[model samples]
Target: LPRRGADTPSLAAKRGKIARFYLAHASRANNWDLVDLSAPYIIGRWLLYPDADGKLPDRGILDTLASHSDLWHQRIGIVATLALIRQGQTADTLRIATRLLDHRHDLIHKATGWMLREVGKKDPGCLLEYLESHFRDMPRTALRYAIERLPEPQRLYWLKRQ
Candidate 1:
């Protein structure tokens, strides 16, 4: 189980250690929920947290995990972005969605599509732009999921593109 707060003075350092420990034991995070809950709190937060200098951390970790062979880890890469998404950050979700577009697993397709739909919820224009480029090639499951919340006419447009 992850502790909420460790030591305030060394919060960042301790969180980094905790994130590393959880990631090192990622194999134990076998299911989608586990990965979803843990990634944002640990891995995602660790990588995205700003330091005292106000410099944000790099997001390469998500890209690496997104391309990992293990299904659970791959799911974690996308699902973790939910944290950023809720905070109105959509760029990471879009980038990760692009990388996972060709993945064959239904679970990966679902996760990617879910995130894309969420991005749409926050920024409809962004989702429209993404679908314009990739809707034709998107897996049926993903495409359907991505357009699930669109108005009927708009949803029909993307469905027709398939």
Candidate 2:
């Protein structure tokens, strides 16, 4: 079980240690249920470790973290990556988003779509291109999320394909 410590000067260090412990334990779990239960702690830790300027973990570190054995951890890692992208880390975000779209997990599919939606806000054409190219392969939930915020005509155009 994860510890809930009272706030203190070393709170960050404690949280970091807890996160690492959870991540290590979660990585060894053979059951998906256990992994699912541990994901929140791992994600909470990564979010808390944002850089001084509020940037997310470095791309290399994030990528390595994404390699954990648990699918739930991968999902949370992808969501963290999406959050980073939303915070202006476009290059790394896009790279991870692309890889996540290919993942077998439905949650990963949705997370990738959600990230693409954010990217769409800044570059609709890129999202449109990605949608057109991948729509046939994308899960419906993912496709819907990717196109949800587009203008009515565009949304209808994509939704009609389902």
For 1-51, candidate 2 gives per-residue lDDT tens digits of 224754343554555566666657654644445544554345434554543
Query: 40-157 in candidate 1: lDDT tens per residue?
Result: 7777666666533445657877898898889988988898897788778888989999999889999889988998999999999999999999987789999999999999999898
Which one is best on lDDT?
1
Scanning candidate 1 in windows of ten residues, the lowest lDDT window is 1-10
Off by over 4 Å in 2: 1-22, 25-57, 65-67, 160-162
Q: Report every candidate's CA lDDT.
A: 0.82, 0.63
- Residue-level lDDT for 18 in candidate 1: 84
lDDT of 1 at 153: 98
